[model samples]
Target: MPDSFGRYPNMNISEYLDFFARAYGLRGASRREAVERVPDFTELGDLVNKPIDTLSKGMSQRLCPGRTLIHDPDVLILDEPAAGLDPRARVELRELIRLLASKLQKPGPDQLTHSHRAG
Candidate 1:
């Protein structure tokens, strides 16, 4: 999985996503598949050509998960996925996560956990 630096400061979203797809040797239809998969999982369609550094925190957060999913991994592990999101972004991210879970194969016991506390 990629970390926060997964996005390049000087690269636009399409360029950044293409870079990773190529790095993973995703060519031809595979490359297009990897590239197309990101926007399906993220709400960054309008920002696809925007520079990475110009994105908001919520926008930037979507990049990491998109990069992580680019290679179509069999398993996904997310830590603090909603740590800093505003309420709307948090809800959007939660829905996306749930969607991902439904699409992926069933996970084993203890593979997923959720813990929330009210302040």
Candidate 2:
């Protein structure tokens, strides 16, 4: 799996978002609409031109959600979404997940389901 920084470490945030948005078949107004969603949902506005490698873990984590939602999928399945996040980032991710769930019309219990494997 690609690390949080993604494959294009040299690409700035706007370029990265635009590339993925376009790759997902978004164009014209749809592309603009998808690109517009990033800033609305994450704290990435100021970091738009910053390279992905320069982003902090929290900021990098925020990007993943935006990328996943660019196509506006009906369901989102995340595995260990909070795995490497710091406390604040984890909270932000949780809230974002909730917002996504609501927007995707998939409301349910607040808790996420996970399988704990005993080592």
Candidate 3:
């Protein structure tokens, strides 16, 4: 995950995603499970197997969040995720962010919702 999606001509989207997931310490069952959720989470659909270099800006944009989220960080912040997208894509991205924030409240460990105080 560069500041922008790099042109990995030899790698497909799945490979690209897996690379980041592995770097984030998600391995074995957890890595596979997390990677499996990316397509749905990013609305990547059938594009998962497509080569990275062939993706358009919109499709490439989807990779950003998917890559960062493979480990389910306690907090997520986006720096203009919709910056280069069209109006429709921007709207869709907004809805996606909202869905990610609101719909991901599944039961888990007993850690405080905010464990570390944000400075």
Q: How many pairs of residues collide in each model?
A: 0, 0, 0
* Per-residue lDDT of candidate 1, residues 28-67 (tens digit): 9878866766866677877888999898888887776677
TM-score of each: 0.74, 0.77, 0.77
Residue 57, candidate 1: Cα error in Å is: 0.5
Tens digit of per-residue lDDT, candidate 2, span 1-119:
12344547889888888899999898998788768667566768877888888887777777877787677765556656666766676777878866754554234324432323211
Report the number of backbone clashes for model 2: 0
Residue pairs whose backbone atoms clash in candidate 3: none
Runs in model 2 deviating more than 4 A are 1-5, 101-119
For TM-score, candidate 1 versus 3, the one ahead is 3
Pitting candidate 1 against candidate 3, the one with the higher lDDT is 3
Per-residue lDDT value at 107 in model 3: 30
Each prediction's RMSD over C-alphas, in Å, is: 3.8, 4.3, 6.3
For candidate 2, what is the lDDT?
0.69
Off by over 4 Å in 3: 1-3, 102-119
lDDT of each: 0.69, 0.69, 0.69
Candidate 2, position 94, lDDT = 70
